[model samples]
Target: MIKRRLNVLLIEDHFIEIMKFKKTVSFAEIQHSITEAKDGAEAFKILEDKSRMPDLILLDLNMPKMSGVEFLSILKNSEELRHIPTVILTTSDNQKDLEECYRLGISGYILKPLKYKDYATKIEAVLNYWSLNELKKY
Candidate 1:
């Protein structure tokens, strides 16, 4: 368990996927506050408010408004927001997507697991690791 509660921004389009992620996180036993965004545009709007800035961002590659890559480009270029750790949490196994995300300065890229159990396990590990890792908050 984390010593402190983390504020996480989850940008995903699919409602079912969002719910699954929330469920998985809940079972992980990690203390966190998750703010959901349907798309990158909404996520960016939330980020505009410095007080609401998230400790981490879980981004999906495909979405209706402003894809994940576009969001990452903007976030990485921003002096104020660049320090926040952004991880790609998507179903896309595209090699190009992986390379582009890394090039754009993503902290990590993870392929979404197919099974619910696997998803929960992967999320638990990720949350545990991040909770231990040091981050530079802006």
Candidate 2:
């Protein structure tokens, strides 16, 4: 069976983090089309335009302009955009941040692993789980 290619929107501020994420995904062998945004503001702009909207979103917590929680608040409130699933992919293991993300209805929260191989494994697990899950019509 052929694996499905995912359209992923990645909101990350750090270039190095983005590079790690890409490398992990590649190592996992997950076929995906990723759209990168430097911060929550940029990601929100992309979300506003329906044509550029993604199948899923992986957000970073602490970002310039707007935070991940701020973006999630708007995203969950929007009737046109609420159906899309979003997960928190961040280095922050802060309890408050985790609680806030859960309260805002994030699909999952993953703390970034320090090891590259471990990171790739976690990413692969996420991809596998989501691939088997069904999405609602947007």
Candidate 3:
């Protein structure tokens, strides 16, 4: 099977987490391009460009400006952006958060592992799945 290079939008606040994700992708030798957003507001700005719409969005729950659930609500409500696959990549393992995300139509919900190796494995699996799966072009 041909591996598609994904355009991933990572909405994360922590600098270290962003760096770690980039490192993991590099270590895994994945060719996907990543776009970083410090918060949900920044993410909206990035998403405004229809020509550069991401194939997948990896969102973190705790953010300064706008929370992940809030962002997800707005995203899912939009007719134009609703079809883009969004997955919650957060440390929050709260049952309510998981239920809410699923209700908001998130493609997946993943809890961030404490160990680096586990985190890398999960990230790799998520990326691999999305890269191989059929995605709608905007």
Top candidate (TM-score): 3
Model 2: CA > 4 A from native: none
For each candidate, the alpha-carbon lDDT, in order, equals 0.88, 0.84, 0.94
lDDT of 1 by residue, 57-124 (tens): 88999999799999999999999998899999999999999999999999999889899888888887
TM values, all candidates: 0.94, 0.91, 0.97
- Score candidate 3 by TM-score against the native: 0.97
User: RMSD for each model, in Å, please?
Assistant: 1.4, 1.6, 0.8
Candidate number achieving the greatest lDDT relative to the actual structure? 3
Per-residue lDDT tens digits for candidate 3, residues 27-77, read 765689999999999999999999889999999999998999999999999
Which scores better on TM-score, 1 or 2?
1
Worst 10 residues of 2 by lDDT: 129-138
Indicate the TM-score of model 2: 0.91
Q: Which stretches of candidate 3 lie over 4 Å from their true place?
A: none
Instruction: State the displacement of the C-alpha of residue 33, model 2, in Å, after optimal TM-score superposition.
Output: 0.6
